[model samples]
Each structure stands twice: as structure tokens, then as C-alpha cells.
Target chain A: MTGRHDPYVRLLRWYPKAWRDANGAVWVDTLREQSEAEGWSRPSRGEAVAAVVNGLGTRLDARAAAQLALGGIAVRAAVEVTMQIASPGGISVQDPALNGLVWIFLSAFAIPVFGGLVALSRSYGVLSPRRALAVLAAGAVGICLFAAAMWASAYGFQLADDNPALARVASAAIPLGAAALAIGATAGWLVVDGMLSRTRLRRLPRAALSLVAGVVLAGLAGYATMMTLGWVTVGVTVVGLSMRSLGGWSSVEPRVVVRSRLSLVRTLAGISAAISMLGIGYAVTAPAWSPLAENPTTAVVHAILVLLVGALPLVVALGLLAPRPRLHVWGPVALVLVAMAATFYGYTDAPLSTRIDSSVPIGSLALGLSLAWWVTARLATSRGDRLMAGIAITLACVVWHLAALLPVAVFVLPLVAGVLAVRGTLARREPIQAVRTAPVTDR
Target chain B: MATPLTPSAFWILTVLASGRRHGYDILSQTRTASDGRVSLKVATLYAALDRLETDGAIRADGDEIVDGRARRYYVLTDAGASRLEYEATAMAHAAKAAQRHLATRPALLTLAPVIR
Candidate 1:
């Protein structure tokens, strides 16, 4: 029932819109020409699948150097995880099922996921090398020590069961190694995020980028600090690094007016500040929070923490995937955040100290109020200033749990970071704005 | 320097060596010149064309819309022609040596089995 050109049109759709614009008609004509020559009105199903596979592979493989880089990391992850298990003190896995699961996680997921992310970053290149430099340092250190830890464990297992020397070294190394990989993998993602963000805001004026930074910084200084350590960490890291990037980091980024609605971006910044205040009936709010609440914010903070880590990302991911302005490659970003959430879940099982929880809020409140004033005074418009002043006064009061109520403030981390990672990868590899199309279709 | 070209790029250059050709013509002529040994897919040919153009081995000549089917023409560059010539020479030498080696081999080591 499909038209004569339908199959070819579908095949072309496997590629990018810009690609379709340039070569779609001609390419489809060739497919039709070939099919006609073969006495078939349409391409066989095999060709269609091959075309789809080819398109996805193009996004994944990116380039030969990137392919090698990713391939090496995947192989390295196998070595790292193997060493952890083989080493006596690396991990104490007595349960048979858990032990099997550990091995499976090491072998199956580590290489493909981490290496795949690294490969994804290659297509985007290094948008702002600042954060990448930091993540890379962590990853590189992790790699070296991980290799040492792995070697100690593997050799320790072979020589004797009671090798204290190797056990001591590996026990010290394994967790550090995994955390390093998490950091390293995250670095690739941060670069992907930077490139994606750069692409998304390409059409907006430079002032808008700084304003967006100001608003995110406000959230970091205000609401996000209490509930999200990782969220705050990645946020501060990105803001610090991306400021340079937004200023003109990528030489390759095209200087074209974007198809993006610029007003949409300003709305997004406004939304960030409004969501951070959890001042409503402050019960000390969180691990970091309002000192004025004294003890009342505890239960509310716990609820916010649960909501932030648990339900928020899936909601944010769905929101981000909305049509009209979709991010092409977000799978890796989601994967990294999920890993972070898994780490947070691990920490939850261990009881957190009440002293650190209660004591940190008062100090954080002083910091938050002070920061709110500076941000509002220096950057925001009259409307944004009013919102901040309101949030600030609320932070000073037990009258409202202003910053801690909404989990949406926490969602901003995944929203911004996820959106960044999404677009640099295509549906998508390489930012759509970058000149990086042909290597995939390379015959 | 004479670097080895991919088979698809080689055949494409070979077809373009004759004259400028559009996408469909390049596909058909590549099949013909290779004596049905080589066939290029549409996506692949376009990717190859893009890479070759990027590498300065080929350039777009012009465009024509014939009978509602648009065709973009491409011509091989001097770099492409020279590279094609180098590949052809290398292949020719290898082929000549192979034929010489084949001609020297005996039909049967002991005898022709009295067939003659």
C-alpha cells in the first residue's frame, strides 16, 4: 500500500534532516534506480534494516580514532572489574547470586556503556575542555590505580589465599577504581553536555548564555546544595567550565541563527529560580538548608531527597524528549545519572550522621542568603530580582519551606546535563550544528 | 604519495575517469567497469562522494533535473585521476606477475596423462 517512493523515503529518514535536505532526493533516486534495475518496485526488507543499522552505527562509531579510543576503554573496563573480583580485599562477595551479578556487570555493561560514551564525546570533540580536564584527571588517576588494584588482586588470587600485602592494596583500590570510572565516564558525558548545550543555544545572543548561567548558579547556591551533592557537583563543574565554552570554545561550531525559540531558553532560566525555594513551613528542609527552621525541616528534606533521586529523572527525561526541539543523544547522560543515583541508593543503606545533616544547614543557609542577594543584585531583571528576594526572605523564615518543597529544582541537574548529553549524540551523533556528517555513510 | 584507495572510491574514480556522471550513472558505470564485480549502495555511494569531495579527490561538476529525477554530477579531480592511475599500475604489475607465475606451472607433474 506504500507509494513507489515510500521505501526510499523511509530509508532517507534514517539519516538526519540536514542530510536529507542535501542528498535525500538524489540518494532516494539511486535506491529507486537500483530497485527498478533489480525488477523490484521497492527495496527489499534486508536493505531497509541495513540502512537503519548503518545509520545507528554511524552515530555510534563516529570516527576511527574515536572507535579505537572507545574500544580500548571497553577492554580496559574488563581488566579493571576482573582485577577487583580476583583481588582478595577488593570486594567481599559471599552471596553466589550477587557474585555472579557483579561479574556480569563488570563484563557486559562497563565496557559498552563507558566506552560507548567516550566514543560519543569524540564526535562532538572537546567543547569546553575545562570540565573534561577535571574528569579526565579523575579517570586517568582511576585508570592507573585501577590497573594497580586489578593487578594486585589477580596476582594475589593466583599466588595464595592469604596474601595480606596484595589484599591491603586492592581493598584500598577497588572502590576508588569504580568511583574513578564513574567520574571518568561522567567526564565524557560532561563534554557531550557542553557541546549539546552550545548547539541548543547557538541562536541566542551571548548575554542570554551568561544569564542562563546566572540562573543555574542561583539554583546551585540556593536549593540544589541541600539535596543533591552530585547534582550540585556537576552543576558547579559545568557552570565554571561552560562559561568559557559559551564564550566561544568550539572553533568548529557553525555561526548560524538557530531554529530554537530564544524565549523558550529565558523561560527555562526563570523556571530554575522559582523552583529552588523550599521555604514553606521549613522543617530544617535537608542535609543542607535553612538555619531558621532549626529542626522543623528534617522530614520535609527527607521527602525532597527521596523525590529528587527517585522519581524526578524519569519525569525530566520524558519532558526533555518532547517533540519540536528534541535532544538526539541522551542515552549515555541518563545512564551516568542512573549510575550516580545507584551510588546514592548505596549510601542510603548506611545511616547518615545527624550532626553533619543538622550542622551543615545553618552554614549553608548563611551561604544561600548571601549568594541570593549577590545573584539577584548583579544579574537578574526586576521580575527575577523580586522572585529571588522572595525566595531569600522565605529562606530567612520558618514561615515557608521555600527551597525544599519542589523536586523540580533537583530535576534541573538532569534536565540541563541530560539535554547537553542528548543533542551532541544524534538519533544523533555529533552536534547537528557541527560539520560532522559523512563518516557514517562513508562507503 | 600514492595511498591505497577503498574499492568503492577506486571504482567511483574509475567511472569518473571517463567523464562527469550523476549518481545513477556513476552507480551503473561502476558496475559495468568492474564487469559486474562491484556494486555500490545508494547511501554508500553518497558517503563516498562526500568523503572524496572533502579529500579533494572529486568535486561537484553541476546539476541537472531530467524527467523529474534530479541528478548532481561529479568530476574526478587531478588528485583522483593520479591516485587512480597509481592504483591501476600497482594492480597491473601484481596481475602480470600472477599470470607469469600461473603460465610457468605444469598441467601434470608426471605427464599429461596421454590426453594428446
Candidate 2:
């Protein structure tokens, strides 16, 4: 009988029931052989116990694998939905013809953001700055190369029509923009690396370099933006002034992390760089009689708009997070309020135009202010002081949610808060008390 | 002439020098070799493996398939062997010198007995 207490039944318990049922004879034979080989007078309890444990473990592992396989389908579906939501505009342009031309271009811009986020999140305890830097550098290089390839494919092989003006402008602007990015990146690298080398100045230099780089880059960005405006009216005046203010604020902060500043700039740089790259890609891929050649203005404006909008939250976030000599959360708070008001105004007046006019600027301002307050509070105070920072960040995310797609807000806000919380927690736990009361052994 | 290896790396390399092994095998071997003085976590083992691979001190020999599952195997490279040798020599020399000094000091000898 296959009962529990019988010797054969008890021996059967040494294996998973399923396994025992299937290969019980083989295992029983092996155990019998092992017992004889050892010259044992009797089968040991320990051997039986070992066999039982091994069999149970195998059964559990198989069960777990089966469960995981079932679960994976749901997980993959969720991840795909999340990715689609995370994609800008909540749309997938999957037309094979369009995708063939566009996916490479879009991926080039998107990969850096993905890489940066991954690098930032993955670097919790053991990762060093050097390693983080390497990841970022690799991401940047990959984007640049992708952009170049796309540009070549779009333009290098094509013979331009009689219009030399278009070619001349491209020839001048593309090389100039590339040079500026290269020089700016090199300068940023030098400033950051130099500051990092010193022990005492390690933290301070990061913020300082980022701010300076942001200002210099902003000027180059402004010149590019100015070229596109057909009529420099009141709207242009407001945008121009706001741009200067944003650039000024970006460059002035001295106590923020360099990476934070770099991230802010890189987001903008990615858009601008992508715009330039997109032009090259379009030129390479499109036919000689393409409509994109009519006016590169819209393309340039779109790129600038995206870069400026995306960079705003990042800048504000860093500004908030840096250690301020005084209580200056109000500055960023005011900026957020203004942006919110603008978004409201834009929503009531004209919805389509609002996407560019109000939403972009407001989103930028909210992101910048929120990030600034969070970073500043984190660097300046203990865990106890984080409640205000957390509240401010939560508010900014809420504002961002209102202005932009919910998924963007969802992904960014929690990440910002999570990073701040982790930093605060670790700061509190610093100088971890010695576990042992005995004198530390000198090796 | 060689860079000094940390005690953790030296111990790990020594264990692998015997033969290719999996994570659990290396962990148990290290504990036995160090007489239960050294203990490593699965996380630490993987991290060390990453660094060792990057440094070209060790290579993944292959994987052993058992019951449709695979266990990764690692082996020490020639460079790893030389590094272990260098570290062992340095440690042995330092240990010998310290023992000699301790043995010769009469005051230390007297104190040692009292402490014991």
C-alpha cells in the first residue's frame, strides 16, 4: 500500500511524490547500491533526509518555473502597455514605410533617455562615478553614431536640385552645431573631471560645472531659436526673455550635482542634437522632391520646443536639490505657479497652440522647480527635513501630470521622489554603528 | 612587480585554481580553505565574478547541463595564477617576518603567556 508510515511508503517520502511515482524504483535501487557500497549495516536517517530535501527542492523549483512561465505573459503585456504609454504622444507609428524611415531616428533620441534612467537607477550602492560616466558616455556615443548613419542615409547619396541655398544653409549649420556640441561636451567633461579629482570640492564642482555649461549651451540654443522666428513680436519677446532667465538660472546654481546639470542639458542637447540629426536623416532618406525641404523652420522649432520643455523639469529639479546658502524653495515654487497659470491660460485660449505655447514652458518650469527643491533639500538636510521636499516634488509631479501625458508624470515623479528618499535614508544611516563592541582589528 | 591582490580576490582565485567550479562549489571551498574565516554572499560572488571577468583573471569555461538546467562554471586564467602566486609570496614573506620578530622578543613572550 502507498500509505505514509510503511517502510516502503516512508522511503517513498524521501522523494517528491511525482518523482517517486515516476522513478521511485531507480532511486530506491541507487540508495540500496549506495548503502551496500558504504558497507552500512543499515540505511542512515541523514541519507534519507538528504534525499527528501533534494527531491522537495527540485519539485519546488519546477513549480516555481511553471508559475513564472504563466506569470511572464502578464508581465510582458504590462511592460508593453507601459512602454507605449511612456512613448511620446501615446502613439506607435508602425506603418512599415514610415517606420523604416523613422524608427532609427526616434530610437537614436530615445535610447539616451532610457540609458540615462537605467544607469541612474541601477547605481545604488556599489557602482562608482567612473562606471556611471562610462555608461552615459557610451549612450551618448551610440546616439551620435545612429544620428550620423541616419543623416548619411538621408542626404549623402542624393544629388540636390538647383536650389544651392538649402544645401549651403545645411552645410553651414550642421557642421557648426556638431562642433558646438563636441566642444561643449569636452568642456563639460574637463570641468567635471577636474572638480571630481579634489576631495573637499568633489560635491560643489558638479553643480557649478553643470550650471556654467547650461548657460553657455543655452546661448548657442538661443541663437538657433532666434533663426526660426518669422516675426519677432511680443510672443517672441516673452519667449526670448524666458529663455534667458531659464538659461541664467540654470548656469548660476553652484552646489548641485554635475550629473544632474549634465542630465538637464543632455535632455535639451538630445532634442537639439536630434533635430539636427533628423534633418540629416530626412535629407538622406527622402526623395529629392520632398516637402521637408520647403521650410526647415517647423522642424527646427519642434526640436527646440521639445528640448526646452524636457529640460525644464530636470533643471528645476536639480536647482531644488542643491544645498542653498539660504531658504530659496520659494523661487522655484513661484516658477511652478507661473507655469501652471500659463498652462491654464493656454488651455482656455487655444488647445492646439497651447501644446507648444503653454504646456511645454509650464512643464519645463514645474520640472525644474520641483527637481531643484528636491535636490537642494536632500543635500542640505537630514531625513526629517525631507517631508517638505517630498511634498514639493509630489506637487510638481501633479502639475506635470496635469500639463503632459499621465505616463510621463507617473514615470518621472516617482523616480525623482524615490531617488531623494533613498538618499535621505542613507544619509540618516551614515556612520553605521559598529556591530561589535570589541576593538576593531587592525590588519 | 605585480599589483597586490585584496584578500577576497586572492581567496577566490586560490579556490578556482584547483579546478573549474560553480558558485556554491567556490563558496564552500573558500570557507574550507580559510578554515571558516571567509564567507561570501551570492551577490558578492557575482560582483567579484564581473570584476574578475573584466580584468581577464578568470573566464567562464562553460556551463554544465543537468536535468535541463545549467550551472555556470568559471576557471582561473594564466594571469590569475601568476597574481595568486605573487600575493601568496608577499603574504608569506610578511607573515614569516612578523613571526620571527614575535619569537625573538622576550617581553612579548612574557606578555603572551600572561595573556594566554
**Each prediction's Cα lDDT score?**
0.48, 0.45
Q: How many residue pairs clash in each candidate?
A: 26, 25
Rate residue A98 of model 1 by lDDT. 40
Candidate 1 regions exceeding 4 Å error are A1-5, A61-443, B106-116
lDDT of 1 at A2: 29
lDDT per residue (tens digit) for residues B1-116 in model 1? 46567688889999999999999899899999899988877766776787678668999987777777778899999998998898899889999999999889987754766765
How do the residues A1-443 of candidate 2 rate in per-residue lDDT, one tens digit apiece?
A: 23455343465564446656644543444344445545764346655555544443333322222222222222322333344356544334433233333424443323333232323222221222233344345434534444444443344323224345445533543564455455435534443443343323434766676557644643442242222211112122222222222221332332333344334433543443344444444434444445643445443333333333443444344444434533455465456555544554443333246354436545654654555463544343334223333333333343233345421332243334334333421124341122223322211
CAPRI-style quality class for the chain A–B interface of candidate 2: incorrect
- TM-score of each model, in listed order: 0.40, 0.27
Deviation of model 2 at A392, angstroms? 21
